[model samples]
Structures are given as structure tokens and as C-alpha cells.
Target chain A: MKKKDVLLKALKCAFPYTLPILAGFWFLGFAYGYLMNVSGFSFVYPLVMSICIFGGSLEFVAVSMLLSAFAPLQTVIMALMIQARHLFYGISMLDKYRGMGWKKFYLVYAMCDESFSINFTADIPQDVDRGWFYFFVSLLDQSYWVSGALLGALFGDLVHFNTKGLDFIMTAMFVTIFAEQWMKEKRHFSELAGFASGVIALVVFGPQRFMIPAMAGILALLYIFRRLVEKMWETGEDTE
Target chain B: MKMTLWQQAATIALCSLSTMATRFLPFIIFRDGERTPAFIRYLGRVLPGAVFALLIVYCLKDVSFFRYSYGLPEAAGIAATLILHKWKRQMLLSIAGGTAVYMILVQFVI
Candidate 1:
């Protein structure tokens, strides 16, 4: 296939996978932009932050951080904590992300939850270029978020609509991914451990600081049961 | 708003830097040719399911059981997503349906 044909085929394959994210990111990004607009910042903040940070939750948190007294150390620490999950994503993608050369950098840079989930799970057709497929997925998802944030920041005051529960798109997306993962794997230990540990951490640490503890708990539990979990997958008994 | 323009820029830059650190650290630690540690490779295999679960919980971290809506809209929305996904296996339909359900419940019913 020609280079353009391969790129076009990859983009065509990638677009369908990103449609859900398009809706979710636009709604959430618009909300972030609108919030920033009302908080007295110009459209520049969202545009730059969305492009730079690219993590939706952290960018939203950064809005509050920006509003508060300037504390660069706190800002860095908070950003690290909020985005710690990307560490797992990076590890999981280490092999797959290799060998892409320049595109590898953008893949890791724009490794938001939606992009990571789609790139990791989507089954590219045999003829499609793997690197270009992943690139389009990441690029399209980022563009949706950036455009949404730009729109919200620029025309937030002009828009008037009831979008009270529109943010649920994200939660729905995550839930669907979780469910799909559940069905794909035979062993439920990791999934169960994650759910139980997450709930426990949330209950113990409260919403303000549950992520670190939850992640720690997950790692510890997964490590402790490493032999057993690996055995389950190895024996093939864990499958449905 | 309280910070000067430079301070605001510094803070945003720090945020971008810190976020980049987390995303890049693993690849940096285990360079291209070096053998990744066995335990780390094990983690790569099993960690995704748990991480996805954690992300789902993370998204819902702000919900309050004792608050005004009592988390009903979230619960209903998730339930709708579960059902829709289980039935259709269509990603867009499940998300759109669940979000629409939540929007309605919060807008009028709840």
C-alpha cells in the first residue's frame, strides 16, 4: 500500500474507536474551559494547559491550583500525584510504544486515559500500520479535547444550556472499559483486587487523597499474589 | 488570579513538567536494549485491569453518599452503562445512553 493509503487506512480505523472519547472529552473539556473562563482566566489558559498537560482531571485540578497562591513545589507534587496512574500506563505500553521513533514521544506525551485505553485495546486490522493507528487515536483524542477547551474558553459566556450531568460521559466510558476488560480476562483477581482496594482506600483516605493509597494498595496486593495470579493465567483455568 | 503572570506561567510549566515525568519515567528507567526487570514485566501484564478499575473509581471519587443527590445519578448512570454495554457491546451507545440517563435523572427526576 502507498504511504498515504496506509495513513488514511489507519486514521479510518482509528476514528471509530475514538468516537466515544470525542463525546466524553468535549463535554469534560468544555466544562474545564467554562470553569476557567468564569474563574477570570482567558482562553489562553485552557488552550495552553490542555495542550501541555493533556490530562483532563489534572488540568481541572490545575485550575484550582492556579487560583490559589503560587506554590510551584506544591503544584509539581500535586500534578505528579494526580497523574501517577500514567506510570502504570507507561509500563504497560513500554513494549508496544517502542520502535515508533518520533511518534513514540507524542504517544507517551499524549497518553491520556482515553488514548491509552483505546491504543492498548483496539485490534488494528492486519493491513493497517500499527504506529500510525496509535498515532491517529492519540492525535484525534487530543484534538477533540483541545478544540472543546478552546470553544468553552472563548464562547463560554455566550453559551447557555443545561449540561448538569454531561460529565457522566467520562465515568460511563471508564465503566465500559472496565466491563470490557472484565469480560476479556479469565482471571478476576486483579480486577477484584483493584475494586476492593480502591473502595477501601476511598473509604479510608477520603476523596481528597484516595488515589495514592489506592495505587499502593493495588501494587502491594498484586505483588503479594503475583505467583497465584500468574499461575491462573498460565494454567488457562481462569478463562470462562 | 492572585499570582503574577510569571508565577502563573511557572506553575503551569511545573504541572506540565511533573506530568511528563510520570509518563516518561518508565521508558527512561528501562532503556531500549536493557532487559526489563522480571517483576516489572509481570506488573505490565497484570496491572492494566487493576489500573482501569482504579481509574473508574478515581472518576467517581467526588461522589458523596450523604449529599443532596445521594449519588443516585451516578449510580443510575453506571447501572445504565452496565446494562447497555452488556446488551449491545457498542461503546458509543453505552456511553451516550448512560450519560443521557444521568442527565435526565439529575435534570428532572432526582
Candidate 2:
């Protein structure tokens, strides 16, 4: 139908998927903004950082980087290490993200964990425009984050509620997503590899330095088992 | 804030730039119109399941199983989420229920 109708329909379809993210990002982003505030930065810092960076973990880590003495090299290296996971996200989304025209740029830029999960997994209706669906998902998710940051930065100490364990929302979100993926796939090799490699890497490398190693392990395991994995897909085991 | 405003701006700019670099690199390397390698395409299909798993583990990596709370709170939260999800199959319900359970446990019980 009309171009306006296409975007509206996609926006309607996309909003529901972002509701969970609304909660998670608000909680997490509020905390990030609050931290930046108490750490002596202005509200502008969180607003800009949330809009520009958009990576939760890195944004949090950047607070400390900002606090410390200026080390440009260290800053670049840290950003790369914290964000290397996005490379995997990019690789996974390459095909699905094709032919989006200009939206492809913003899609790649806003490819955070939450946005990627929804865009990659959600079964958008055929009538809805896929590109617009993806765009609205990313846009809505980022808006939640930016607003939350602004809220916390502006009024962090004024309201005091027990949000001690609220961060668990993210872990819970990922677990549910993983479970959903598990139910969808016929074979568990990739999931098992991901889990085992992550745990082993964590145990071996420790929490502070395990991400890259965990990623490497996952890639290696997947590579080694490519024949079987491809055969499984070839046999029509993947539901997607 | 020991760094000057200019330095701070540069730092944030560098961070945003580098983060974008990682996010955009793969797509840049494997352009859209050109034929993507078979192996990369295969990865695009299978990586989601594994990446989600990795994300879960990454979120919980900081929990100290051997220390004070002993990760009971985290374990309980995850169990609640999985059970609630499997039972109802509603994303919001599972996430909120698990988060509520964890909040109560941490704020009061634990």
C-alpha cells in the first residue's frame, strides 16, 4: 500500500517486541546514567553516550575510562575488546540485513544485543515491511535507553526504590531468548557449544577477560563441527 | 575529570568510532551485492542460538559462586525465568516474574 502505511504497520508490529527491552534498558540505562551522574558528569554525557555508543556494557565501562587518566591507546583497545561481540552480531545479520537501503547504516550502528536478538528471531508478518520492522525495533529500543539515561541523570537521587536485583532482568531476557532458540532448533550442538565454551572460558580466563576467549572458543568449535552443523541444516533441522 | 574537555570529547568520540568499527566491519568485508561466502552464510544461520547462549553466560559471569550469596539469587532468578517462560511462553511474563523473584530474594531474603 502507501509508504506511510508501510512504516506505520511495521511500527505497530515492532513495538510489542521491544516492551521487554523497555524495562531492561530503562533499568540498566538508568543505572548507567545514575552512575555517570554520581561520578560527577553532566546529564549531557549520558544522553550523548547512550545515543552515540548504544552498547550497554561498553557505555558502562566507558564511565570508568572517562574517570581515569586519559590514555587514548588504552581507550581504543578497551572499546574494541568490549565491543568485539558486535562483530559476531554483524556477521550473523549480514544476509538478513541486506537491501535495506539507507536503513542499513543505522541498523548496523544500533546492532546491540537486544535489538539484534529481536530482529534476528522475530517472525515478522509477510505483509509488513521487513526493513521498516527492523528499523523501528532498533529505533524504539534505543529510545528507551536514551530516555532512561536522561531520567536517571536528571533525577537519580530524588526517587529511591529497591532496584537492587533489577539487573537480573537482562540475564533473564537472554535466558528466555536462548530457551526459545533451543525449542526452535532440532539440534543442540551450537547451543551446547556456546554454553560449554562460555563456561570453560570463564573458568579459565576469569570474568574480566573471558569474553574474547569465549568468542574464540565458540568460533573454533563451530568451525571444527561445520560439517555436521551444515549437514544438520541441510537436513532441514533448523526451523527458521 | 583530569582530562580537558577537548580530551574528553576525543575519548568519547574514539569510543563511539571504535565500537561502530566492530559492528560495521563484517558487513563491510562481505558486501551485500557481491556473493557472500558459503561458510559465512552458514554462520549467519547458526550463530544466533550460540550467541544467545554466550550472552546469557556473559550476563551471569560476575556472580561469585563461592562467596557471600553464593549465586543462589542468580540461580533462583534463572530458574524462575526458564520455568515461567516454558510454562506460559509469554516473554514479558517470564522476564517480569523472574526479575520480581530475584528482586525479592536479593532485597529481602538473601
Candidate 3:
């Protein structure tokens, strides 16, 4: 990949779809920053966390864990469990990730859902360089997060803004992703079934148990109805 | 007591440690791992919706059915969001727009 092309791909990855992620990075960083400042930590709290511990939820939890004096081992366990979903991502991404160089470690390290989601689709143009693409994606996403945190920590005193509505971005992002997937598959049973099962589980189990059960249910449902799912899937592909 | 630069750095470093822990599966990117197993593919298939659904609740966990967050307007904003998201596939617009509407309601109507 020529230097020129790499720059181009990095720019391409920066705009459009990445905007939502950037927004998230901003708010999450800002909130983390506010919390750190109020909780009696310095700017370094948010900065180092953003740069190194880019894990979304865990970072928030980490703040309280420190204030409350949690054991390091406990924090480690909690972090692993909270982000355990990434394990699933690793399994699915094996094929796509199989051949990079030194960048491989960082790429894997930076494998958050946002990056994975973006990468899951879009033809990784043979002409474009993967490393540059990954670098931009990782760098931009991290920047959004870190910068947001840093900014929030520095100027939190002056700001009295309400965050009442900001959290919806996560929900909105997911809806967008799900809708896109639905559009791609177009009313396929497996997709619909999974979605339906997930909703039902949400209502029944409430929020706490819904995710794991619903995910497991979807897989089982697909396996049970493999023939029908395949038929629908084939039909979907044919239409495409 | 005010935290020093190094202490802040180290403390946040501890915090960031958890993030890495979650993201910390040892396998290198683009190497060594075989095709995603069927189970993982299954996890991927359902995980998005399931997780999203949970996030919706988590975000609104404080909003009570018997009561409202910032009152009726904020409540309406949420419903408007769900409707707009479902009706029009405009997520960013719906969320931002819905939030703005909620903010307005809280500011003026409430």
C-alpha cells in the first residue's frame, strides 16, 4: 500500500459512520472526566485511562472501585466479566484478522465493538491498506474517548450542562446497527427470531438476565430451525 | 488531599487495567486463530439485539412507569425517539433530535 492510499483510507474511515462513535467517545470521556475531577482525582486520571483503559463501562466502574477501595484482583475480574463479550467478538473475527504484522497486537488490543462493527461490513478494499485503516479507526476512536475525558476533567467546573438525554446514543446506535442488519437480511426468520427472542427475554427477565439468555436463545433457535433459517437465508441472498 | 501527577497517572492506569482485562484475550489480531466457531457466530448473531435491548433499559432504568424522569415532556421525548427510530431509520437524528426535544420540555414545559 502506497503512503498516499493509506492516508486516503484513514480519512475515509474517519468520517460518515465513525461520527456516531466519535460522539460516544466525547460524552463518555466527558462524563468520566467529570467524575474523576469531582472524585478528587487529577487530569491524569482521565488521560491515562483514555489512552490505556479504553474499555467503556469498566472505566466508569473503575472510578468508583478506586474511591471504594476495591482489590486489584477484584477489579481485574470485574473488568474481564464486563467486557467478556469481546471474547465472542474474537471468535467471529478470526478470518478477518488473520494476517497483519506488528499492528496485529494493537489491532487486537483495540478490538472494541465499534471497530469490530465497522470492520464487520465494508469490503476491506484490496487496493487500500488494512494497517492504515485499523490505525485510523483505533486512533480516532481512542482520540474521541481520551480527548473527551481530558477536556471534561480540565473544564468541568465551568460547565453545568445536563446529561439527561445523552445516554440514548448507545440505544440509538444499537437500533441503527440492528436496523441495518435487518435491512441487509430483510425479514429473515433467523434474524427476526433472534430479535423477537431478545425482546421477549428483555420483557420477561427484565434487563439483568436478558442479554445472555437472549443471545443463547437466538443461537439455539437457529440451530433448531436450521433448515428454515437456511431457506430464508438463501432467499435473502438471492434477492440481494 | 490533592493527587499528584504520578499518583493520578498510576490510579487511572489501574482503572485502565480493567479495560484491557476485558479486551485482553491473548490472541493476536490477524493471526493464529481459526475460523470463528459456530457458537461464537451464534453469540454474534443474537448478542447485538440482546445487548442493545439491555442498554435501552439501562439508560432508562431510572425512568419509572408510575412516574417520569424530567416529567411528561421527557417521557414523550423517549417515546418519540423509539417511534422515530422505528419509523425512520435515522438513529443519530432521532436520538439527538429526541434529546433536544426532551431538553426543551424540561426547560420550558416543566
Candidate 4:
């Protein structure tokens, strides 16, 4: 196939996987832009930040960081702490993204939760090229976010609709992914450990400080049970 | 904003730089051509299941079970999502249906 044909075919195959993200990212991205606009930053802020940062939670938190006292070091620490989950994403994607040449950089750069989930899980057709499929998925998802941010920043003041619960789209999406992952895997240990650690850390540390501890706990649990988990994967049987 | 334009630019630059660092570090450390360590590979296999669950928790981190609504709306929304997903096995429908249900509950019912 011609390069153009391959690109088009991959884009066509990739579009459906990104549909849900188009909704979720636009809603959340628009809200972030609107919040930034109302918070007194210009539309330029959200436009640039959404493209550059690409990580949703950190972008929202950065809004406050922008408004507060100027502390660049603290901002770096906060970004690292809040966006630390990308480490897991990068580690997981290492093998899958290995041979993409130049596109690997952008794939890693645009590795937001939604894109990662879709790219990681979607069983692409045998005919579709995986690299282009990943590229289009990343590009399309990022575009939805950037466009939504621009729209909201440009028009936030005029809209007064109640979007009180639209944010739940994110939660619903993650829950669905969790369910899908649950059904795919034979052992539920890692999933349960993630849940238990998250809840325990959330209860002990509260929302503001739970993430780091929860991650640490997950690493410890998974590392400690590496043999058992590996056995379960190999045997596809409950090791417990 | 209290900071100068340059300061603001620098702050945003730092934020992006730090975020990309996390995303790129592992791949950098585990370099493509070289053989990846067995332990890291082990993590690559199992972390997705745990990470997604953790992400779900991250999304709901702010919901207060002790508050007025007491997380019932979120609970219902998640329940709706699970049922719709399990029943239809359709990703978009489950997300849209669950979100719509939550919007209604919060907008009028809750």
C-alpha cells in the first residue's frame, strides 16, 4: 500500500476508538478552559497549556499554580507528583512502542490516560498498521482537547448550561476500562491491590496526598507478589 | 497574575518539562535497542490492570462519602456504567449512559 493509503486507513481504523475520548476530553478540556478564562487568564493560556501539558489533572491543578505566588520549583515538584502515573504508562508501553522510529517520541509525549488506554487495549485489525493507528489516535485525541479548550476559552462567558455531572464521563470511562481489564486478566491480585491501596491511601492521607502513597503501595505489593502474579499469567489459573 | 509574562512562560515551561520527564524517563532508562530487564518486563505485563483501577480511584478522589450527597450519585453512576457495559459490551454507550444518568441525578434528582 502507498504511504498515503496506509495513513488514511489507519486513521479510519483509529477514529472509532477515539470517539469516547472526543466526548470526555472535550467536556473536561472545555471545563478546564472555561475555568482558566474565568480565573482571569487569557485564552492563550489554555490553548498552549492543553497542547503542551496534555495531561488533564495536572492542567487543572496548574491553573491554581498560575494564579498563586510565583514558585517555579514548587510547580515542578507539583507537576511531578501529580503526573507521576505516567511513569507506569511509559513502563507499560515500552515494548509496544519500541519500533515506531520518529513517531515514538510523539506517542510517548501524547500518552494521556485516554490515549494510552485505547492504544494499549484496542485490538487493531490485522490489515491496519499499528504505528499509524497509534499516531492517529494520539493526534485525534489531542486535537479534540485543543479544539475544546479553544472553544471554551473563547465562549465560556456566554454559556450557562448546567454541566454539573458531565465530569462523571471520566470516571465512567475508567470504570469501564477497569472492568474490561478485569475480564481479560485471569488473576485479580493487581487490580485488587490497586483498589485496596487506593482506598487505604485515600482514607489515610485524604485526597490531596493519597496519590504518591497509593502508588508506592501498589509498587510494593506488585513487587512483593511478582512470582505469584507471573505464575498466574503463565498458568491462567488462580494461584491463591 | 502576579508574575511577569516571562515568569508565567517559565512556569508553564517547567510544568510541561516536568510532565514530559515522567512520561519519557522509563523509556529512556529502559532504552529500546538494549534488552529490557526482566523485572521491568514483569511490571509491564501486570501494571495495566492495577493502574486502571488506580486511575478510577484517582478520578473519584475528591468525592466525599461523608458529605451531603454521600457519594451516592457517583455510586449510582458507576453502577449504571457497569451494568450498561456488562449488558451491551459497548464502550461509548456505557460511558454516555452512565454520564447522562449522573447528570440527571445531580441536576434534578439528587
DockQ score, prediction 4:
0.87
A108-193 in candidate 2: lDDT tens per residue? 99999999999988989999999999999999999999999999999998878777988888888888888889988888889988
Q: Chain B, model 4, TM-score against the native?
A: 0.97
Candidate 2 off by > 4 Å: A236-240
Weakest ten-residue segment in model 3 chain A by summed lDDT: A186-195
TM per prediction: 0.97, 0.97, 0.76, 0.97
Q: At residue B82, give the lDDT of candidate 2.
A: 94
Q: For model 2, what is the error of residue A207's alpha carbon versus the real structure, in angstroms, after optimal superposition?
A: 1.2
User: Which digits, one per residue and each the tens of the lDDT, describe model 4 over residues A1-240?
Assistant: 999999999999999889888888888888889999999999999999999998888899988888888898899988999989999999999999999999999999999999999889888999999999999999999999999898889998888878888888889988888898898877799899999999999999998888889999999999999988888788885532
Better of 2 and 3 by DockQ: 2
lDDT of 1 by residue, A1-240 (tens): 899999999999999999888887888888889899999999999999999999988898998988999998888888888888889999999888988899999999999998999888787889999999999999999999999999989887787788888888888988999898888887788888999999999999998788888989999999999889989878765344
lDDT of 3 by residue, B1-110 (tens): 44454554555665566555545453533236556556555544544443443344445544445554434664576666667777876757766666667667766666
Preferred candidate (DockQ higher): 1 or 4: 4
DockQ score of each predicted structure, in the order shown = 0.83, 0.85, 0.32, 0.87
Question: Candidate 1's error at B69, in angstroms?
Answer: 2.7
Which CAPRI category fits model 4? high
